[model samples]
Target chain A: MIAELLFAVFFGLLLLGIHRKVIARIQRRPGPPVWQEILHMLKFSFKTTWIPKTASAALFVGVVLVAIGIWSAALFVVISGGSLLVIFAIYMLHKIVEHGFGLSSGSPYGKFGGVRSVISAASEIPLLVSVAAIAIFTHSLLISDIVSYQEVHGPLLITIPLAAIAMYVVLISKMPFGPFSIVESKELVSGYKTEHFGVWRAGLEVCNGLKTYVLLLTFILVFIGSLPFWLTLLTMLILVITLSFVCALSPMLSPYDSVTVQTLLAGLMLVYVGVLGVMS
Target chain B: MKKKNALALTLVAAGSGVAAMALSMASILPGWAYAAVLVLAFPLFVLGLGLYWMAREGEEDIPFLGY
Candidate 1:
């Protein structure tokens, strides 16, 4: 437990550093310094807190903290042999709360962000279904148990290639990289975060990094079970590089297109997995 | 003059503390020892800050993340 907790935090920070570098490279700009995230957090800690005139102060604070807290808990649960149903429920609750907070802000961009968030949630359902299908195949949702199954039954990847694909689709949609970068759309003038500033902006940025680390960790566990730590780390690096390249090369697309492609691909994967389950 | 050095040292100490805590949590050390070391980690982190402060004559404009 101690090890897992420490590993989680360490990886989280390392990921923050890596993300800054990745984004910098992608934009062909010297992005924020590698340690910028930590420095920014320190700077934000000392800054004056600001509340928007049109927003609910209490709700705004709650929204920011809730997003951080929920995300933290979800990531923690991902490590412990927790129930999958519970994990899924918590993940959903986090999204719903995020949307509610956006709507509560009463800003036009917040409203737009809320709507975009809802659409993304709608698109994520098929991916969740794939999780359920995989759970059924292994007859367990505890990560440890699932990994053990792999030792005995073989890696889940070979059997559930389609589900693996589904997971990738879900990951991209959640991270919403490349073409699906609409949530962070500059044209929306920062979208949900337009009204947020100072420490609040800092919190959101950390949360963004946290979400990336947590989700990537999830992908690693699901797709590649217990390996040597170095190997796991290396695999993660490679995968992120590939995603970064894809993001750079691909043209940004409309949210509509994002939702469509993600849902269609995920749906296809789910069906294939379903058929595989029936056959085996 | 001393106060400024102390403040920078404190900030560095905090940064290192976070890093050490993270290491203790993630490392594959025996669980009980890991927990005990993590507790000790905080003070050692502070000591580190004190050392950094003593070494500095007086400096502001601390480098980002170097601490």
Candidate 2:
């Protein structure tokens, strides 16, 4: 378990680093090495730290803990092949983590970040549609069962392409600097994370690594079915690279534009789900 | 963030981490029991360790009042 958690922390950050490098290259600039995020996690952990005086002391610190905790639980759920709903629920809870990180700090930027996170809540509705589409096909919400269904019926990506696309959009939105990532837009000065420094920020980094790992792996397991261990790692690499390409080419949207885009996508997904539901 | 508080948090983190691993591996415990232990332990573990590391003595600048 320790080894698994460590892998999530290290390899997840490594993937993020690769993501940055890919984006930079696409934009014609050198970026940090693939190990930079891991180094960053360490660097933040060892820095001087303190709570902001204006902060709601308990909530300010509490959210960081919850951020890591929820993602860790998410990892376990994926590892155990538990209900997919649980993972989505945890992802929803992640919105609260973002909100808390911003509001509890008593900083205007952080508060705006928090508010944007909630507004961006629309971004996750397509994920719900995707999950519904999956359940419609498999007649089960359990990951283990879904994988078994895919094993017998071939990959869901081939069968329910729209759902796969919906889930992909979700993973994209979660990526840094993507069209919907306004909560952390530069105007917000790191957005929700502006106030969480030193060890606190390191903890948030740990959570993010685990989140990236779980979300990517879940997408693979659900849509592509399972693979051999090393193959699974390779698939994740390819998957993130694919996402990086999309992210690299796209410009960040204005917050309202982002919401319009997400809402429109969600509407399309809902239509797909509605059609799938009626057909099934 | 004091020394004594930091030490306590660290111990909680260490103990919780160990317990989570143990419960997951235990044949006698039900799966939900292990999950419950983990749900409880995880936040404590992350929070504890972060605070422990944050306990270093310093005369840092006041909180960001504004730019």
Candidate 3:
């Protein structure tokens, strides 16, 4: 099981590398190799590190532990086919981690990143709607039941693609360089991640890698149903490629614009859920 | 001393991982026991791995004495 955690972290890092590579390629620029993210993690790990002078000493350190802990918990939840609600809660907590990270640093840039993370909290609502849509259809919030449902009824993608779209939007919003990614935009000097250098940064990268894997896996299991291991990875790659295209081709939106887009998407998701509620 | 601290943490993390693995393979144990180990093991692994790397050789500074 611990081995599986390592696998998810490494594979997710590779996926993130793939995301960066694809985005760079789309703009006619040569990109780093697919393993760059893994190397990046290693590089960050070996650097001398200390808490920032102006930071809240305990929260700064505590938040990194929380980031890893929550994600690992999410991984276990996903793997055990546990409640989707728990995953949603963890996703929500991740936003708080971001908000906390910024304030912990007391850096202007970090604080702004944290505030933006809060403002962008609407991005998380679409995920709740996606979960709601899934619950409405399957009549159960457990992931195992949902996958079994796909087995019988075919993938949820065909029955209610709107939910999948909403979910994908949620995924896109969390990814780097996507339209709603204002928190980590270049100007913030790495956003909430600004002060978390060296081992702390490496830990964050591990969390990122795990998060990428868990979210992609959840999407596959929920919408596409189960497949062989290799095939599942291929599907994840395809999904990442699709997201990379969006991140690559589209310019990052301003915070207000990002919120507007999330709001519109959220409204649409709510309407779909409402319609489904009425129909069923 | 800092190096020893890093090594100790890493060893503890590795020990936890080993314990978790062994406990998982044991059919006699209840499922919750393995979960209990996981709750302890995962953070130790992450923190151990992190601090292990963060520790620098030959860079031990004088301890900051509160004025």
Best by DockQ: 2
Question: All candidates' lDDT scores?
Answer: 0.61, 0.86, 0.85
Per-prediction backbone clash count? 3, 0, 0
**Cα-based lDDT at residue A183, candidate 3:** 94
Model 3 spans > 4 angstroms off: B55-67
| Runs off by more than 4 Å, candidate 1 | A1-10, A23-30, B1-67
Q: Report the C-alpha lDDT of model 1 over A76-128, residue by residue, as the tens digit.
A: 55665455565567567756755755666667777677788778665566557
lDDT of 3: 0.85
Off by over 4 Å in 2: B23-26, B54-66
lDDT of 3 by residue, A173-231 (tens): 88988878999998777888887888878889988999999999999988998889999
Q: Per-candidate RMSD vs. true structure?
A: 8.7, 1.8, 3.8
Error of 2 at A267 (Å): 0.5
TM-score, chain A, per candidate?
0.86, 0.99, 0.99
Please give, for residues B10-61, the per-residue lDDT of candidate 1 as tens digits: 5664555456556656774443444444334333332333333332332222
Best by lDDT: 2
